[model samples]
Target: MMLDRKGNNPLLAIKFFGEGIRWLGNSKLRKFVVIPVLVNLVLYAVAFALGYLYLGDMIDRLIPDWLQWLRWILWPLFFIGFFIGGFFTFTVLANLIASPFYGMLSAATLGIAAGESATVMEVPWLRVVKAELRRAAYLGVRAILLVIISIIPGINVIAPLLWALFGAWGMALEYLAYPLENAGILFSEQRKLIGSVRWGALSFGGLAAAGLAVPIVNIVVAPAAVIGATLYLREIEKK
Candidate 1:
């Protein structure tokens, strides 16, 4: 579980995620991953169903009559863009709804990672809710700004790339927040900690973003990312 503190190996993040997948098989952790997976499953299923039904209508409205000629080119791009946007958006919603379970999951993972008995620590409910709310507010404002940038002509040419990077960074913050908060790290400190290991955090979050973009694979990515972030925090603290 030891990592080179001074090394800049971003692949280590992927390795950590792999370790998370392996840990999901551990009996003690199975219960923790199940609820989140089910929650994500239902939410994502509903989202995909809605998208399937309304995506064409949405495109039609957005593209205009004169732009119908570009429908062939724009359809796939819009689909992909919506998919990625939905993935990150719903991910934040799912995490907020399941924050309590995730708090316990992070604690259990950290305890086990430290070779201690896996026990859930007593965190104040209000504190947990407030912390999650802070993260949501932070994400919400930035998302609004990103949406504005996305619609701007010419400037929006790089919107996809911007969203991709933002999504990766957001994922890193989302999962890492659990373990970091459990250890009494404030949101500001959490960002600083992740920023300290910028490449690795982005890699972990990017790999997570990619995995969660896939259908069935995404069901498990949320919990696995939680475990991976816990392990990531443990290693980072060693520095």
Candidate 2:
């Protein structure tokens, strides 16, 4: 499990993510991935179902009759937005609900990555919940700000790019939290650690976000992300 830490290669994150998928096949790590995958499957299925049912109505409401011609252009953008938004939103909720399991998964992955036995660590449910709440609040406030910017006059033009970056950064923070917390790193410090390797972290998160946008692929991406984040942190610590 020795990771390649040669240079500050942004694509290294992607390799770690792939390593995560490969690690899922490891018998020792297989058990740790199950619950998170199931949680993702259920949450995403429901979210996609609801989105499918209401997406048409939402699009109609957003575009007036005079702008009917714009539907052809805006429809795709709206669909992409809905997909990314729904994925990130449900991802946060899923991670919150499954935080305890994720904690154990991260610990076990760390153990395996270190060439040790896969030991399930005890999860402090209360603390994990509180941490998740803090992260949610942090993300929520920023998300609201982004939404406001999205609706502003000229400044709104770059909103989509902003959201894309935010989503990538958010995904990095979301997955990286488990291992960082297990290592006794606080939320504030975790941000700094991620910031230190911003591009690599974002690459990992961006690819993860992209993978989760797919249908069946999204189901396993959560657990894979957990493993990937663990690997990413391990490499960061080595540096």
Candidate 3:
């Protein structure tokens, strides 16, 4: 059941979306959806509040004397803090919303590794939180390293692109890790599973990530993408 490692399977992208739609039917979408939206609202509020508290004074002091006249130029940088804060907050929240479904998806994805039919079942919140925290800690460290790289003058120009890449990979890993664990695979085994089909996972994940970047649209898209990622794992196993 180990997937073919040599090529990308484009059809999986379509299947991913279709499966996502199907998975959404399992829920009272209104009930599941409301929590994520509220989580998002809380995230935004926290982001804004932190920005005003921390950045407001920092920007005032940090704005150079000569650049004081160009306060507008420094304005956007102040908001970067908000985005950074929101990024981690959203990841935690998205995983929380999708947690109930993750075990079912994981069962399918990991069943391939186990050479068996995986039962679809509900995942407990504690399990989801534990799994996500493990993966998130790894990605958070990598993101910090990427931030350091961006501080370098010559490299800073490509920082945006690098961060985007990291974000995409992080999302894919986060999504995949849940299912892999449910199937009783450890982190190392899950890494191997994904490593074999990295391109397909990354490309499909990047597409799903488009939803994460949007505002209101992201609320629906986030859980959908997790489902998509789950389906993506199932399809990849067939290859």
Give TM-scores for every candidate, taking all chains together and pairing residue i with residue i.
0.82, 0.83, 0.70
Model 2, 102-182: lDDT tens digits are 899999999988889888778679999999999889888999999999999999999999988988888888898899889
Number of the top-ranking candidate, with TM-score as the measure:
2
For model 2, how many clashes?
Answer: 0
User: Who is ahead in lDDT, 1 or 3?
Assistant: 1
What is candidate 1's lDDT per residue for 120-209, written digit by digit as tens?
987788887788888888877888898999999999999999888888888888888888888888898878778777788888889889
- Clashing residue pairs for model 2: none
Root-mean-square deviation of each candidate, in angstroms?
4.2, 4.4, 5.3
Clashes of 3: 2
TM-score of 3: 0.70
lDDT of 3: 0.64
lDDT of each: 0.82, 0.83, 0.64
The global Cα lDDT (0 to 1) of model 2 is 0.83
Q: Per-residue CA lDDT of candidate 3, range 139-226, in tens? A: 8799889989999999899999988788777776766676566656666677677767777667666765666666556556665665
Off by over 4 Å in 1: 1-8, 50-82
